[model samples]
Target: DRGPVPVEEGQEVDVTVDSVGRRGDGIARFNNFVIFVPGTNAGDKVKVRITSVRNNFATGEVVKGE
Candidate 1:
């Protein structure tokens, strides 16, 4: 059985971009759950706001970065 996702829409979280997706979105993970953050790059540490959450992955917007 599947559990509830680790994040919710409108939530903010900090993560390091692990890799870039095919469409250029940055990939990060929270509790091993994938979060796709646009406008970020690999090795980027950023704070992102969760925009959409799906069954297997979530999408977020970069709120700030380091």
Candidate 2:
């Protein structure tokens, strides 16, 4: 069972990196929802564009320093 996805494709949002996942991606939250972003680390703040959205989580790319 899953809830409605809070984000849509190409949506840009800002989040604070909370931790690193097993694949070395930075994990952050939007409204307590999880998003994984590569090339980021814990304590890093960034803006991301949503690339994919799944049932429980989403994937995004860092668009910072742009």
Candidate 3:
């Protein structure tokens, strides 16, 4: 069984974009959980605010880049 998701809606976290999704969103992993962040690219280190969280993945918006 899976543990609880590492992020929640409205939470801000730092992440490094590991890859790009098919639609071009940046993909980051937090504690092995997937987070899709828009307006970012692969190799980018960014601060993102969690917008939505699902069972398997989460979505976030870029707050800033590092």
**Tens-digit per-residue lDDT, 1-66, candidate 2:** 546788988999999989999999999999878999999999999999999988889999999923
Q: Of the candidates numbered 1 and 3, which has the greater TM-score value?
A: 3
Can you give the lDDT of residue 44 in candidate 2? 90
Q: Pick by lDDT: which candidate is best? A: 1
Error of 1 at 14 (Å): 0.5
Clashing pairs in 1: none
Q: If ranked by lDDT, best first, what sequence of candidates would result? A: 1, 3, 2
Tell me the deviation in Å of residue 48 in model 3: 0.6
**On residues 1-66, what C-alpha lDDT tens digit does candidate 1 reach at each position?**
368889999999999999999999999999999999988989999999999999999999989887
Model 3 collision count: 0
lDDT of 2 at 65: 28
| Each model's lDDT | 0.94, 0.91, 0.93
Query: Among these predicted structures, which one has the highest TM-score?
Result: 3
lDDT of 3 by residue, 1-66 (tens): 588888999999999999999998999988899999988889999998999999999999989887
